[model samples]
Target: MDTSPYLQSRQRLVPAPPRAVFELLADPAMHPVIDGSGTVRAARGGSPDRLRLGAEFGMDMRLGVPYRISNTVVEFEDGRTIAWRHFSGHRWRYELEPVDGGTLVRETWDASRLKHKWALRVLGFTRTTPGNMERTLERLAAQFDGGATPS
Candidate 1:
């Protein structure tokens, strides 16, 4: 219903096709660019194949001054939706849709619990995380040959 205040940001992009875009979303290796934090190394529960409901993994997230968590894939549907809820009390989701010409990737984040309030407050408006997210999307639309396939 009312999912603002807790809402982080959402952006849509038409990049490549659903297959190519889904390939990136299905893998965690290509997340650091969009997530702006972690370098996924050896997914705990499942790795590349963990793109479905209840798929969980421990992402060594280096975020907001060294933040990490083991996240569980809460919601998943091939080429449609992928969501994760962190054990630490926050979550995020991404919705993908194959438009007539290309794929649309929409992303959102929940920061109600304040993942890094102190660090965020200190930064004072120059949030690199969100900036990275936006930049990553733009880059993908600009450079989505659909060859890398998200590790």
Candidate 2:
């Protein structure tokens, strides 16, 4: 059994360059299309088209009921890494590395600084989040399939 508090998906090799993949990830409007968790509905109006370090954006979300949340890009490194955090304090991070074939992507759900870590544990986020991250990576990879590299 995994004992780490943070949830991370296994690295996936996407058939696209790091810049291409990073372009997709930096666009808030494309999030719903590539989201594997099915929670992201749309980008809220007035949200930035592209995210940069410290940029804030909102998303329409639904788990059981519809709601909205704002996230701030907490970490960004051009075409290599990006991470964001919401009010809940946990962070969602994506790290990209250029490999021989394509870009190696790893998604992580970080709860180390969460205010209510036990609450999330009780809510079973630990058990389910890794799978969600995996699906998210799958969807991300599919976006680059068939040599459709986005600029």
Candidate 1 deviant stretches above 4 angstroms:
1-5, 37-48, 63-67, 113-129, 142-151
Q: Relative to the unseen true structure, what is the C-alpha lDDT of residue 40 in candidate 2, on a scale of 0 to 100?
A: 95
- Estimate TM-scores for all models: 0.68, 0.92
> 1-151, model 2: which lDDT tens digit per residue?
2358655456799989999999999999989977877899999999999999999999999999999999999999999999999888888889999999899998888887776789888887887888777778888888878533222
Superposed model 2: Cα runs more than 4 Å off: 7-9, 147-151
Model 1 weakest lDDT span, ten residues long: 34-43
Locate the minimum summed-lDDT window of 10 residues in model 2.
Answer: 1-10
Deviation (Å) of 84 in candidate 1: 0.6
Instruction: Indicate which candidate wins on TM-score.
Output: 2
In order, how many clashes per candidate? 0, 0
